[model samples]
Target: MARRGKKKGRPVSGWLVFDKPVGMGSTEAVSKIKWLFQAEKAGHAGTLDPLASGMLPIALGEATKTVPYVQDGAKVYRFTVAWGEERSTDDLEGPVTKTSDKRPGEAEIRALLPNYTGVIMQTPPQFSAIKIAGERAYDLAREGETVDIPAREVEIGRLELIETTPEGNSIFEIECGKGTYVRSLARDLGRDLGCYGHIATLRRTEVFPFTADDLVPLDALEAAAPKREEAAPEGGRPFAAQGERFVALDAFLLDTGEALDCLPQVAITDDAAAKLRLGNPIILRGRDAPVQADEACATARGKLVAIGEIEAGMFKPKRVFAG
Candidate 1:
């Protein structure tokens, strides 16, 4: 995608999608952007292993506040699996944990994918960042301790086995909801088909509103002008272009169009914005119910600059994105 250049001397505070290259950890990607932008804060929506790469969402400035909203969006990945061998980590990064009797062909994989679709529970591999009792699960697993990481609900909206190489390599694409581990999915697919498998390669093609095409290359990000790294810390801080841009403070959620489509927008007067800025929750009128922005920025005259969604009959925020 073309670079969406900002006005000269503008502090940027918006979403930046990166077409991550192989060998960079997700946190490493965040650090690169934080250093490049030199903003005060930054965060990535999700994690991608160093061995696997693709669309990684980097949140800049106040946009970091909306990271969780995009995290819930379904992700699509393109991965290749090696047949006949199973790894302890479910991917090539781990040691050869087991071997199977036979290999499955392209046709067999395509036929087996349908069974993994729709709602399913996934038991994440112990070699994951998921915390069990506040310690990283992967670290514990490496120490040979058995920790039962509970199975969580996830959905594979679409699964298509695209091709199989003559050398026992199978490629597939999957669109799944949040909390999905492509590695685990690879392991499970192997078990379901009775031909053990290990992920040889993986790449995230899309994450909800963002996609690989929407991203800037790591090299490009590392080369942006007016380099903002000097005064900023690790994640950096929000940098808006020019004066503050008006992004409805809910643009991130609206980008998904789920909560936005389901919830009605309610405009408020300046008075409401002022009270909201001061931290007093107020319900605004909407057709379905009263909606409030979980967070609001105060302007002049208690005007409603930004607002978040509130619970029914109570002033509690559902979500409020940054402006």
Candidate 2:
């Protein structure tokens, strides 16, 4: 057999906190980010609907291993609900399936907030990524088939009514655990208040371990890309413009260990790091060593070594990292 050639693209690794603009799908953003960086691998921590915009943490190369950490983190969204219309898709993108002239008073909305602020059962919108019988709910809905999407418990940490617009819209912000749907919140809120509603504007401001402050707009990122040279150098291969650009973009990436920030960290010596890399357990020594931890990360000389479970005073590697 012919020797397998090296995989294409750079092995760039880190999180790019992207401020994804509206109208761009999450998968599309990941593909573009990968191409721009010439990365060998890329993935996103959470999915942001094309209609929504904000903190989308795109992980490249080794950072992809930590995606679950960010996905499990709480998310914050600021959204506006337009009263008098309930759309089939639960947002402005869908056609209005129901409408009512009745509008919700600010007081009525404020009173209802308390009822939604906590753990509650919520039915996801018809046009969601939820799978039913191995098929996407949205695909079935698009085919004009109504799927029975069962309600499930979702935690709403905070729900605040920021302001009610005179145009018959209410702006609210929420910090919610994973799988909470803002569209469902608006739809259910309207039903309780005797006013049909749909999401008019939605923006995700934060994903745990990242915030609006870390966001970089698509335009800014495109502008940062290096301009490519027109021709190859004489008697030599073309100048590595793509490689140079990769270096330039690398500046924007957050450290891969940043994704594991929520987990407790333990510093390990080179000897211990070597053992962990070989899929062996290392005994935790010293008085300050943790007796036990359900999950924690070990670092050696400021570099991540492994994420593992501590049991019986030994750290058993679960996922090891390559430098």
Candidate 3:
């Protein structure tokens, strides 16, 4: 009997801005993309609920290292709030917990927008991913346990009412910093307006440097990959022969450097890049002499070398990237 070895996928790297469709969990979307690309490693910057869709930035191979940077960036979302009913999850997925018929008028909704903008205290939905006592709050909530999510300060850059419907539904667009939950916003707004509400529809339009325009639908990505015929005798998977034509997964990848676009760039010499790669700091020179931001991307010949901090006239490598 022949011993079969584990199959190792290709060492693909870079970011894939996926337009995650509704009804699919973020984890499921990442797995599907990973398999389609046959990537060695994959991860997503943030989790978009199964009920919500759009702009999920997936990181493959080395790009996984930059997930934190993208996750911390600002996000924009457009959602609809359905008045007259409140759900346990704050979104349509959960059971209805309360009901009311008092829908806020357009004038009242506009006035309330200012109260939510800027920095304000927000209590995350009970059925949320937040950790409580080392377990997910949602898990506790589902088990019929009482969950009290405390209020925390979150920054909302902008919150505007887009439209209102006579059927007790309203659409809104919000630009907010990391950690802000749209479900919580909907839940609170209803309380303030004397009407119960829950998120009827939700879609993330932007996540930092990536926008809806950058997203590649799942179907398109699947079509781009070459179809595999069958498992080869040599333990390799063979792609269907297409007469002198083949598409490499790398063609679909955006440079990993794009993930750090929000950071200021500092060009460095080959020697400096080599030093940074070795987890060491390099003193800046010329126009790059004075660091403009506390943190900056150190690049060599236009390729990212490391993300580091500027202190004492030196760029100290905090996170080194594989070039």
Candidate 4:
């Protein structure tokens, strides 16, 4: 058999914090971005629903290895709950499942906020990405199959009612940990306040290491890319040219190590980096060197070597990076 050819696309590595517009799914965003960057591999840190918008961090090439860190960090969402109606999907996208004539007052909503703060058990929306028996819950929900998604422990660092609209829509901003759902919060709040509710609008402002400030809108990225009309072959796709357009687009990518900044950074010697790259442990020197750490990153001459564990002054590689 012929030797398998190397995978196509550029060996790009970094994170792109995208401001995903509403009506675009997370997977679609990843595919589009991968093509634009001409990257060999691409993945997203967290999934953003079609009805939601904001900070979606897309990882290209080697950056995909750090996705879990971003996913496990705190997330902040600003959402609006339209009172007096509960939808099947917990958002405006779904049909109304229940309704109530009752509307909650600001005082009542404020009082209920305490119940949701801190660690609490919450059931994910039925029309969610949760897997059950190797099938997506949303698929079953679309076919009218009711899924009893177990309530999971989620942390809400803070929950505040930003304001209430005259139309009975309550806007809220929440700082929460991984796996928390704003849709479920809206549904439960409505039930507690004797009013039915669904998410009217949802926008993620932060996903740990990345924030709104780092977000680059889709249109901006598109405008900076080489156009299909510029293709040399009339009916073929435009090749990724390492010109002004590519440079402009590449400027948006953050360093791969940016996602790992939260972890302890160990400056290793060139020799130590070589050993770590070969899947070997090296003794850490110096009084300031960490004697023990569950997770840390090793860098040599400002280049990431590996993500590993530090025990008894030894740095053991868990995952090594490719330059």
- Give me the candidate number with maximum lDDT: 4
lDDT of 4 by residue, 1-323 (tens): 79997677767789999999999999999999998877789999989999999999999988999999999989999999999999999999999999899988999999999999999999999999999898999999999999888899999999999998888789999999999989999999999999989999999999998878899999999887767544222354334443344777889999888898789999988888989999999999998999999999999988788999999999999999975
Write one digit per residue (lDDT tens) for candidate 2, span 1-323. Answer: 89997666667788999999999999999998887776779999989999998889999989999999999999999999999999999998999999898998888899889899889999999999999999999999999999999999999999999997879799999999999999999999989988889999999999999978889888877777654442223365433434554555678889889889899899999999999999999998989999889999999998889999998889999999886
Candidate 4 minimal-lDDT segment of 10 residues: 231-240
Give each model a TM-score: 0.75, 0.94, 0.90, 0.94
What is the RMSD of candidate 3? 3.8
The reply for model 2, stretches above 4 Å from the true place, is: 1-5, 228-244
**Which runs in model 3 stand beyond 4 Å of their true positions?**
1-7, 230-248, 291-293
Candidate 4 global CA lDDT score: 0.90
Positional deviation of residue 164's Cα in model 2 after best superposition, in angstroms: 1.6
lDDT of 3 by residue, 125-186 (tens): 89889999899999999899978778999999999998987776999999999899999999
Rank by lDDT (best first): 4, 2, 3, 1
Please give the RMSD of candidate 2 to the true structure. 2.5
Which residue segments of model 1 deviate by more than 4 Å?
1-12, 227-275, 280-307, 310-323
Indicate the residue-level lDDT of 93 in model 4: 91
